[model samples]
Target chain A: MKTKTAPVAVDVARPRPGPLALLAGARRGRRKLGRRVVPYVFSLPFLTLFAAFFFLPFAYAISQSVFKQQRSGLGLGPPTTIFVGLDNYAKALRDPQFWDGIKRVLLFGAVQIPVMMLVALALALLMDSAVIRFRRFFRLAFFIPYAVPGVIAGIMWGFFYSPSFSPIRQLATTTGLPAPDFLGPGLVLWSIANIATWEFTGYNMVIFFSALQAIPQEIYEAGRLDGLNEVGIALRLKLPMILPALVLGLLFSLIGTLQLFNEPLILTRLSGSITSHYTPNIYAYNVAFVDTDYYYGGAIAVILGLVTFAFSFGFLRLTRRQSGV
Target chain B: MRNWRHRASLCLALFLGVASVLSACSGGGASSGGVVQLTFWSFNQQITEQADLFNKSHPNIHVTALKQPSGPNQYYPKVLTAVKAGNAPDVALIEYQYIPTMVSNAALVDVSKYGANGVKDQFVDSAWAQVTQGRAVYGYPQDTGPMGFFYNSATFKKAGITHPPATWDEFAQDAVKIHALGPNYYITAFPPQSTGWFQGLMWQAGATWFSVDTAANAWKVSVNDATSKKVASYWQALVDKGLVSTVADFSNDWNAALNKGTIASWISAVWGQGVITGSAADTKGQWTAAPIPQWTAGAKTSAMWGGSAISVIAGTKHPQEANEFAQWYLTNSGSLSIGVKEIGWFPSNKTAQQSSDVNAPQAFYGNQVVDTVFEQAEIPTTWTWPPNLTAVNQFMGDDVNAAVANKTPIVDALDKLQGQIVQDMKSNGINVAGG
Candidate 1:
């Protein structure tokens, strides 16, 4: 019995030495090396670009926001940059024009986003329905405006908004109706909203339609088996299925509405309604480039960026909780 | 092993792509040669033509003229960015009003260092004053936009008005008589967006809104001074009375009004004659030129509206060559003649002003010697612009436009303009007084 026990104990004490153990060790080593190197290799280009364009500029802008370039006396000599912590931010916060710009954009977004999204969703739903004809043509036609650049689109819409040479005004006059002053101060914001809706609705529609296509056929079959009609299915099943896309679309539109710049910039010369400080971005741009007050502009930009981040993060958090994502 | 090789190749490709992009960005310097290549940026077509002429004449120096967009909104930002990056053109065209801003920013080199002072007597005093900061000359005067009145002669004739109004009171009376003709007709269109023109009117009224104290090195802004208020109220009354239409200048509606005989006249600069002729071509031989109507009777005072100077940017590699080109292009009789005759840029040079090309009658203005009217209208008036004049002007435009839209009183607008200007100047680190 002692001899048998000693042989068993010696067998257990000896380290495992076989082809299977050796192969497992080699596999473990390979996976460890891969775990270390694979992510860097995959992310190198993106990381480089991100660091160069986004991170570096963002860091610089933050640093610049704390400094002020002061011109002494007559401002004839070169300006001297000095550190003025929080002064620029304080000034921006106190500026009426900046607040006015924020209010204008908020008001614009409030009315524009709902109308734009509703129209986009309706078009996307129609295109997705079996009752629709020439779906591809309609999709392509709707998406074409997104292909046109913002500045060019603004210019094209500006022609229709012009009181002097507008074809719409001509039609109104010929029809014995009062020619609407589209570029008048009272109506210009709506005109700008119209341009924004025209430009981005098509883009959002495509996003929604693509999302709608991804809905499983079995789900539709199941809904139909329960006596759900096309509209009923679309309202209950398809809409819920595409809620993530809708949220994403809403976030994009919200960010765009906050950062309004190009349309007002191009419309400045054509209409009196658009001022140099028409929107926050325009105001920051004027302060930075036009006024040559880089510090103040940087502060405004940082504040605006923070506001955007807060809004987006808040929205994402809310949606995540609601959808249990 | 294959995957590693593929990754290596991808990394190499990205490196090459980045290198190529960097190389592309680093391009655009003097080519490796004996030739001195100078880059000139201008919004004026005449400058491009003249640059071509210079290139043909001087083989040692090659100038590449790049055309920028005309408006300050597009062009000024590009210039400012280039100036900041130290990659600005050798020579650039700047409006006279922006000279102080450029000077304060130290964006222009004193051209007097390159013998610019020698041609000081060649340009009009006001034009010369615009290019000089204290004692240092910064640029060569390119063109002058002496203010003048462009009237529709047929409209005046139909209204039984024999002569042009010589004073504001007579102008107002004529506006009433012209408005009585029909609902469509008015004496003139009061352009709400014409801040420069409005400033010209204020200047003619002896209103010096901005002045520099060289000794103390301070800027004085007096935007809502008595003379300016008088000018504002005069126009405000006319606008409120519906005697004048509040149309924007250089707009399609304005041109339509001019062509349709609804707007009888334009109190515009010399450059406006060319614009009117081009835009209202069908009204040829019906237009006439006169001095801008005065605030005081028999007063010969006038003010400049739009003019520009060719300035050498501060860090130009070829400053001497740029100065040479600027001097030659502005003062040379041959080049000035082309600028005046072909391009219709009213010359600032004395010789160019006296040239037969400028003195010749324009058929569009019914054989009127419009250039002579413009030349005679260049009176000695105190016109000063602050370093933050652009900001001040923007505020002024907003207030004035508000007044025009009837959202605010003209006096209130002027008061707000004054406060905003002072506040803006102070915020921009400028010394301000008389707030």
Candidate 2:
């Protein structure tokens, strides 16, 4: 196994210097010109699109968030946009609903990210096991739900949650047992998490499975020679090898949990189980659009974006510090 | 190597040049045939179909109708962005409640100019009132959605009731009786998810959520007023007795219950008939419509549920054609009848209200003249719309839901709602501190 790992290490080291050596041989002035000109040529199309959609509107949203709209006496006249620095942010921060949503998502993320990651990891390992049959079929079957659009998935699950339309409910009735109230206030969060897990577990499994495949067979053979079984190999060998992938999955799940919107929004009509402020994204969406308070919505969005950025960057830093990467 | 670099640079330059040229050509397509393609947006599919019908009748007019998805959260930002871009649709189907917001943004075209000869008078007086911003007519009325009681006959029979209840007290009594028949059965399904409907109930009970008559559309905390509390208490008792499902916004449970006859009746919009009948094929003859039992003898003549109207854009290139199309869609008897037959939308045109199709009995509602029943119950139009009607609806929905969820007491929820709505308005620069 150690001998097998040597070739990959050599390959990584050998690829780096060729590009640097080319630059070293160039004339000083030409090197400067090439470095400046090459990246711009490579980035021109991306920069154009970024300017057209993201940067321009991002700037506008930031500008819009700093201002507030006011109407004069009688509220009879048209509202005038007034420039107010940080007031929108202050109002959003002070809002109990907004803070509650933020706190709820954080707790949701803490539970959901680990649960999803662990399930995905377990499934990926099970599929990779030597005794597993029809691996490709099982992998595809698991991945099928990811292909269904979120809105459609929400609607489909909504039927299952409904007593009137649910086949599950009918089956339960035939058995002389009560159907589970999926939309009950007590269990709606977990029900939503169940959906997110069903939709994404396969996608995450594919990620972990790919990471598992990259592990050479020789390492497993060595573990076998040391009398390590498949379970031992997974615990001692496979798990550590897939740490980066696990971290990647965890980060994605965290972000997804924070930005949860589509399922809850679509499922609103299925049961009175969800409110407009159920999730932070939904809260921002409601404030911005339904409430017509774009300034506050923008503030909430900015806050959420910052939270996502902080969590992502903070995780990357923590992983790097721990792994010594 | 040098030649390769030069060729690569040329390729890059050529790629950028072609991209810019194509983008310019696409921008040019925005204006074509010496005509500007004015975009019109609406929430209702029926309204979009009606617009399409009007466009067909009048040639040389190209109005693109964009439907606002059923949920307002997904719809309003698109309208806001389009307006902010200085390229909003030349005409839009603005629901009556949304006129104030559109007017506030200075995004609407004043249709009052086209109505120089009292053309605005052609619509139901209250329908016209929704579009008016201090004497300037902003849009033409398209439909009116007066509230009514739509009951499932099968469920009623099961409860041993021969007629739909005629008063709130009787309604509750019947609801309790229905619940007694089956453990999970409910008398009626309402959007316990929304406070807007709660406010409508308060209105029926002779109280208003806000002081709409005041210069400032400020919260008067009237939801806790005696009559309003009575309305809330009745519903609360129903919920306590398990006579009403503790469902949030119209969820699958609500729809399934309605279709399964687990819910005996529904207090819904004049337009809800379209959704209910359209979604359930087997329940056609099983349903019927009656006047929504009044809270008191004359507390309210009626309370509206849903309605929308069309407006021409102020800066549109084809104002004349737009005006012609708007007038035809809103007031023309032929065009309005098409809206009813094709899409089941009730027309707001006073003349069309008497049309054979408008007055015709619906077979689905046990062959009752459901349309005529809706017209007769038309509320006196005392309630007015705010620019932030969507927010008002949302807040109303949330606070009421909190009460229903037992997360807060009714008075506490109302107080919370009052504070939040007022604070929200103030943060948005609307003065709600005083009337």
**Top candidate (lDDT):** 1
DockQ of 1: 0.39
Q: On a 0 to 100 scale, what is the lDDT of residue B343 in model 2?
A: 65
In order, the Cα lDDT scores of the candidates are 0.83, 0.73
Give the per-residue lDDT of model 2 (tens digit) for B1-435: 688899788867867786887566433115467544556667656566666676676565666777667563455556765666555667777667667767766667776677523776667677777777676877788887778888898888988999888888889889878988887788876556554456666666666655553644453434456776777677777777677876643555666677677877878778778777865556878998888887664433567665787777545666666777777776776667777776677877777776788778788878887776676674654555555566766876777765666545566666676676665566555656352
TM-scores of chain B alone in all candidate structures, in the order given: 0.90, 0.86
TM-score of each: 0.90, 0.86
Q: Which of the numbered candidates is closest to the native, going by highest TM-score? A: 1
What local lDDT does model 2 show for residue A129? 90
DockQ of 2: 0.30
A1-325: candidate 1 lDDT, tens digit per residue = 2344343222343367677666666766787899999899778888877886788888987898999877877776777789999999998899888989999999999999999999999999999999899889999999999999999998888889876678999999889999898877888899999999999999999999999999989999999999999999999999999998999999999999999998888777667667777899999888888777777888998888888889888888889944445
**What tens digits encode model 1's per-residue C-alpha lDDT throughout B269-327?**
88888888877888899999998898778877888887889999877888888888878
Instruction: Please give the fraction of native interface contacts (Cα pairs under 8 Å between A and B) kept by each candidate.
Output: 0.50, 0.42
